[model samples]
Target: MSLQSSNDGPLDFVKYQNVVDGKLVASSNGETYHNINPSTLETNPEVPLSASDDVDKAVIAAQKAAESWAKVPWDERKKRLMDFADALEAHTEAFSQMLVKGNGRPPLHQKIIYDKLI
Candidate 1:
């Protein structure tokens, strides 16, 4: 994220958020907790410390989305899922970095997942 911690100057973090109803959001209280990289022991990324309200919102959004998705044809859904996979494949490098930054995932772990995606 291009956000600065309260006491720190600037954070060199890749923005991460909770996506609800097609919108990105922070915790209900706007609170965040550090995600420390296991290898470096550095908190490069900070993530939302969601509340029960966030879970409720996400559940409601998922229900609404499921209702709409159920109406879509199976073939169209399949095509869209394939397209998503293709998009992920296209951004394997960047996505891998994000995974590593967001969680302390090893390169091999990412490689295995990418290989399965292929």
Candidate 2:
């Protein structure tokens, strides 16, 4: 099954952006590496290996965000976390499918991840 977006072109399904703070960003060096599946030996060509600079940027962003995000009330944080949990539960099927495709894991195994988060 393909993930289609009307406005955007077809997903490259290759490159994965680095998660900086909470947003995805490209590598500074524009360098990328391939990840091979041990079982099938199928190489995923599009996944960009994040550069070290991305890690530094992500850490800085998280530090900045944490300063403000931590100031919020504990109750509010708990509520938001719970909401996120609920959203994950509601989107279990889609989440599992994405996980299986990216991770090359069986659907049954993906349930373990969701269970662990719960």
Candidate 3:
């Protein structure tokens, strides 16, 4: 099975972007590198080569999220985490497909790890 995205068609499809502050964006310097798929030795998406400015932006965003998350009550945090885990579990097949292509891990192996997480 393949991981298909409504917009991107396939999860492995090309022309990717960097995500910062809850948005998909390009590198500050507009640099990218195509990931060579090991199975087919084919070029994949032009993944962003994040610049120092992007690193700074990402760090700042992460810090803000961490600060807000730290203030949440313990029970609320547990509920949110459990909900996130459930959402991940629901997408196990797509995730397994992605891992198989990206890391060359078998789908079964991916399933096992996801199961353990839940």
In candidate 3, which residue pairs clash? none
Lowest lDDT sum, 10 consecutive residues, model 2, at 1-10
- The order of the candidates by TM-score, greatest first, is 1, 3, 2
Instruction: List model 3 lDDT by residue over 30-107, tens digit each.
Output: 888766657667666578899899999999998998898899999999987887777667667776666566666667
Candidate 2 Cα deviation (angstroms), residue 103: 4.3
Residue 89 local lDDT, model 2: 71
Task: Tell me the tens digit of each residue's lDDT in model 2 across 77-100.
Answer: 899788777766766776665566
Which is better, 1 or 3, measured by TM-score? 1
Kindly list the per-residue Cα lDDT of model 1 for residues 1-118, writing each as its tens digit: 2122234533333666888888889989998887677776777667898999999999999999999999999999998788667755766776676667656779779767766866
lDDT of 3 at 73: 100
**lDDT rank, highest first?**
1, 3, 2
Clashes found in each candidate (C-alpha, N, C closer than 3 A): 3, 3, 0
Q: How many angstroms is residue 100 displaced in model 3 relative to the true structure, after the best TM-score fit?
A: 1.2
Q: All candidates' TM-scores? A: 0.79, 0.69, 0.76
